[model samples]
Target: MNWQPAKKQNDYVQTRNKNFSPPTVNQVLQNAQKMIGPISESPRLDAQVLLAKIMKNSRTWLVAHPKSRLGAQEDVQYRRLVARRAHGEPLPYILGTWEFFGRRFQINPSVLIPRAETEHLVEEALGLLRNNRSVLKVLEVGTGSGCIAVSLLLEMRSLGVVATDISLQALRTAAQNIVNHAIGDRIDLVQTDLFSGIRGQFDLVCANLPYIPRKVLNNLQVGRWEPRLALDGGEDGFIYLRRFIAEVAKVLAPGGSVVLEIGEGQDEEVRSMIRLGFPRAPVRISKDLAGYNRVVVFET
Candidate 1:
């Protein structure tokens, strides 16, 4: 995506020194701080990640060799990435990859950048699978970037996954990730809304669907950079979520379970919807690292 800075700032220009000598790693980091410090929560770390990308090295390497010099092209690339971050573009999208569940996956504007909180949803799903040895099939709705599905297949060798998304662009991005991790044979990528074209029952159904309300999407700085199709959950922020729960009974196998990542302040309401769909199932909510209610699990 083309991410122009929301407001023009000297951060991009100020980082460029007009001298003949190459800029040292420390100097570049300082300049990046000057450009993005005000806008980023982790300015130094962002600077390091960008620089590391340019240098084809790790952040730890950059730290150890603070006096190393950047090539002319490297300096230019670093400044450009800093400008994008200052403008509110997510770092993962700028870098073209993000880490989730301890593994890295390709990412782009077409897909939502995987967040650490979503890892909790993966953890909950893994917990359920660990308890039930017979569970073999899994389905991930709104499988943007295929982070959840790919991670699950990697963790559980015997399981097969059928991941679905309404957007073809999203399906393409997820397809790249499935191929990248060499798990394409085990995961099927389908372009369909929720469970519309899905055929068989799944032992587990998981999703990190759009849950941000339309109105709320406007005010969010980070949200503006992400694809609306991946964030808009309708007026009440549960439109897509409600639909998923309603259709769970059709695809979920006997003794199967459903796990979903939800917005904050939405635990009880989502649990209620899951209960309405599966009246006799056990519905439970799980919290993220910050202790906020973030995942809802439905087990029959």
Candidate 2:
């Protein structure tokens, strides 16, 4: 009995466990890069940005903290975000915010991500409003994420906006952004189809409505995750464009400006619509940095 008990105790003697090596920032990023590199245009940068967002640190900090190990939960969350990005979900939707006109606005799949090209429209509107003090009120049809409205108000303090969206969820998103920028009182939100429930006339009407054609959308990723109600523009990509043009005259003020962000090669048709809607108004076409015919300004 003594020999058997002593042998069992020695066989079951405790052994120290080896130290666990958690995933370092560098290892995590490299793995993410391999997953995202195949799909994303800027895989490395995107990986860094997503990780930075998850870690609540800047991308620059990620560069410096390459050896730093992520906690178990952070690694899981970061990997999830990378998977979404790998699936071709827009970066802004994954990150929940995007820079438009030098300001970060709350964004999601409910609205179209504010395009850098759209900023050309904002800059054009700001430039037009700079000299004139008479343009006090604005109307943004299909306000989406309220990027255009919020940006306009932030840059020009004298303006008030009536942002209308057909989608209530979109209105909620826009409203959050309005509150985020503390411009609730300066802006009024209405859930109505183009100019349906809107009563007052706006001095400036900025509409970045759905201009992408339905036929071409199947091949593009713009509407894959974004709401089709916001991106599908019917047969010629001008269905809503036509409707907005037909009815916009009722809400536009005299000498009012309508600044539109048009898709590539739609400038001609947009000019035609503006000319048909407001015959007396002159249409000014401004190209983006890439030299695409982007922003169209029409004065009524």
Candidate 3:
């Protein structure tokens, strides 16, 4: 709630000279800071990082060489990037990469951006693996950027994974990420809604499904940028979630567990659904950093 908002860099540029180029990093940062002051509190920092990214230099260097000169071409490109940021484009999308679970993931507009809170799901999965030393089968539903699957493989060796998604585009992104992390051989990526074509029992299952209620999504800033299929849940926003519960019971092994990410206020309802669908399966919910119920756990 009190997080620092990154600043827009274009505000500093003189309006009369819309195309006026900043010839130095200091000039760029100063202009960015000026424009950013009214737009956001963290404009200076955001400007530095964006400029540094363009120059392939570290933030420290940007601060160290505030007076260092930038070439004509570099200034042109930096201004364009600054203009985009000024319009509220996400920095990660601009850079094309995001660090998740200690690894770098190529991120695009195709999937929901991986969040730090989801790391708890990964931690939960790791804890399960630790207890089940012989476990080798893992399944990840709605495997967005393949961050969850790739992170699991990086932690556990010789593990077999089945990552599924309903979006062909999302699957393609996940597939590329799986290969990028060199887990293609160990993990099989499939395009299916929930568990439509998934087979066999798995020792563990993980999902970060679309849980936002259709009504609420219309009111969120995330909806404006993220793909709707990756965010919209029909009506109460539990459509995919309900389907996941029914399908999970059929594919999960006895005594195995499934970890799911739930929307802010849907924890109790999701737990009820899981309980009704998997009467024998035990259910639990975990909170996110903000202490909101955010994950649903079911153990058979």
- On residues 1-300, what C-alpha lDDT tens digit does candidate 1 reach at each position? 122332344534543657557779999898887778888889999999999999999999999999999886687677678888877788898999999999999999999999999999999999999887764999999999999999999999989999999999989999999888999889899899889979999999999999998899888875778899999989999999899888888998888889999998998888788778788988888789899999988888
**Predicted structure 3: lDDT:** 0.81
* Model 3: ten consecutive residues of lowest lDDT: 1-10
Q: Model 2 misses residue 13 by how many Å? A: 25
In candidate 2, stretches whose alpha carbon ends up further than 4 angstroms from where it belongs are 1-18
Clashes of 3: 3
lDDT (C-alpha, whole model) for all candidates: 0.87, 0.84, 0.81
Best by lDDT: 1
Clashing pairs in 2: none
Q: Model 3, stretches more than 4 Å misplaced?
A: 1-22, 34-41
Write the number of the candidate with greater lDDT, choosing between 1 and 3. Answer: 1
TM-score of each: 0.92, 0.91, 0.89
Order of the predicted models by lDDT, top scorer first: 1, 2, 3
Model 3 Cα lDDT, one tens digit per residue, 10-48: 543343376754467787777766655564558888788
